[model samples]
Target: MTRLALSALLATLALIGVATPASAHTDLLSSDPANGASVPQRPTRLTLTFTEPVPAESATVTLTGPDGAAWPTGEITADGATLTVPLAGSASPAGPYTVSWTVESLDGDFVDGTFAFTLTAPATQQPPVATTPAPPPAVTSADAAPTTTSPSAGSTATLDAPPTTGTSAPAATSGDGDDGGVPLWVWILVVAVLSVIGIAVGVGLNRRAKRGAEPAE
Candidate 1:
């Protein structure tokens, strides 16, 4: 049989060179905010890198938001030839951002694709910077009061004025005999002395009369 048909065509050319690198097909060696990139922030995650080794629930990612709105991805990991996912909320609304994908190629083949990116500024949650509650601490005159200082021009400032409440002026009663303002008891004493003097004079006269009568002198 001609050397067995040349050993069956060298065993079909060594099985088509070993099945052409195991039937190739798994190429996409770099992505991740690439592919038309113009991102100023809006990419939480959506990697891709490949060239073999991607499998584990295969993969599928989708995110579209140039206002057509459908941005939801999460849970799609392949970590070996990189796949990644996660981009769920907040930060996807400023223009261009597509990134669709589908992967399962380690020779199982299912490779889908699409890519775009240009978020130039999509992260505006700035209304919280409006916290203006700090204007209440400025009433200061040294915190409002007690600072009086203004009396200097040949200075004579005796400000003790705080006693103006009503009538008061009556305290001198206790038989008031203060000599120059003499009253009551002082007059009574003077009368008593005069009376004593008169009594004494009378007594002396009586004695003299009695003696004269007894001796005719």
Candidate 2:
């Protein structure tokens, strides 16, 4: 009986050692942009690596802005032991940002943690150096308008202005005998008078023929 009791006690002690470690909650091993680091700019993604693999659906990461407002976040993805939480929208405002994360370990236990970091407004950006486009490379006298330099007063050299061609003016004619023949109006009037005389003669001949054709009475 004494030997059996000792054996039982040893077995119990071994079982307790194994069960205690198994039932313990998971722990965070490290983080990207590490805990308490001073980042020059806000991070777009937060990474949490754990001692064991956690379920993606069971993971939740919340980002709190400097003003204590909740920052938007996208779906969290679990790849092996790493949980990647994508930050939605633009970078968090310049100041202290807080990350709070909760995850369920493979053993169905919930583990939660919190971390913080500073963002320094990206160094003021320097206003982009303001390139003035180099002022279009000063136009020289030779390049502008192609001016021809006149000869100096004491020098014998001379540059004459280029001769301009003049277009000839239309010919001018005197009114006398300007028309080569009789005027068109006079010819038209003569033709009209002749047509009237011809019509009168034809009418007189028709009346005489009717008189001759009548029977004697």
Best candidate (score: lDDT): 2
**TM-score list, all predictions:** 0.32, 0.55
lDDT of every predicted structure (CA atoms): 0.79, 0.82
Error of 2 at 199 (Å): 99
* Clash totals, every prediction: 0, 0
Write candidate 1's Cα lDDT for 1-217 as tens digits: 9999999999999999999988888877888888888978887888888887788486777888888878887888787888888788885667888887788876677988787878988677758566666666668543444434466765444444455459888986665665457787768888888888888888889998888789553
Query: Where does candidate 1 stray beyond 4 Å?
Result: 7-11, 27-45, 52-101, 104-183, 191-217
- The lowest-lDDT stretch of 10 consecutive residues in candidate 1 is 140-149
What TM-score does structure 2 among the candidates reach? 0.55
